[model samples]
Target: MNERTEYWWVHHDSRIQPAEVGFVGGIPVHFRFLGTAGQVRAESAELIERLPAPPTPVFRPPPAAAASPAVKPQISGSWLWFIGILLLIFVAQCSGPIFDALK
Candidate 1:
């Protein structure tokens, strides 16, 4: 007699050890659990029978397409402005010392 081993499929392509209580698709698709070194597993027939009927796929409205190309924020301009301000502050702070040394 084959022992009924508990198994789990975390997702369509992910798996977890020690089995978890979850289901992926309406139909339990058999997949190999990577945690078990590619050991094949499937949802228990009892669990499949216990699961609520899969919801019928509904027609979802297509996502609205962008009217125009996306405009990326101009981050470089802000960086340049910050550097310019820092340079000005440094020059202002050193002007007195520089003048005194020149004199």
Candidate 2:
């Protein structure tokens, strides 16, 4: 008779944070939920093993001056306005809580 080893990571696929994996006979295996309430199984050997290198630094042009605009400010009223408003709202919210606590 021959006996094989098997392992499983309980609840590997849940809404909870930080998925986990287990090993069986030195071979790790885990469950993954791809869709709604559906579970898919996998093994460490089956999974691709690669160490991703750090991201390369993004090259950005120097700040633009009124005279020589290195990076032209987006002239559209889309992202700039949206992000600007978001920043203002965040600052206002933060200050509101602090002011209320102080008062």
Candidate 3:
């Protein structure tokens, strides 16, 4: 995935089947499908100001140095607070089981 460029393509190709593509910045490009041998085509552009950017294929950051650290979820609290939460969930979950067992 090139952050500096964007690309689009049709997933499947059939003989003599035309492919339709849309771009954010420029006029949509379409290729008259010649055949299975010439079905796929692609185009790209440098990230430019005011250019409608195409949707990225994947939602992931490019690997690089100086990457921001992921935020860690904090689980710090008083022991009593932790016990209370666990007890509440335990009761809620076991209430069904306890009632079923009783019957």
Could you estimate the TM-score for every candidate?
A: 0.33, 0.20, 0.24
Candidate 1: list runs displaced more than 4 Å: 1-66
Residue-by-residue lDDT tens digits, candidate 2, 1-103: 3333232223333333222233456554444432235334544224333223422337877676767848866679787899999999998879978888998
User: Which residue segments of model 3 deviate by more than 4 Å?
Assistant: 1-77
lDDT of 2 at 79: 78
Pairs clashing in candidate 2? none
TM-score, candidate number 3: 0.24
- Model 3, span 51-95: residue lDDT tens: 245444456977785687878766676777989999999999899
Provide C-alpha RMSD values for all models, in order.
13.6, 23.2, 15.3
Error of 1 at 91 (Å): 1.3
Top candidate, metric TM-score: 1
Give the Å shift of residue 6 in candidate 2.
Answer: 99
Clashing pairs in 3: none
Superposed model 2: Cα runs more than 4 Å off: 1-76, 96-103
Query: What tens-digit string does per-residue lDDT give for candidate 1 at 63-93?
Result: 6777667999989899899999999999999
Query: Lowest-scoring 10 consecutive residues by lDDT in candidate 3?
Result: 42-51
lDDT of 2 at 90: 92
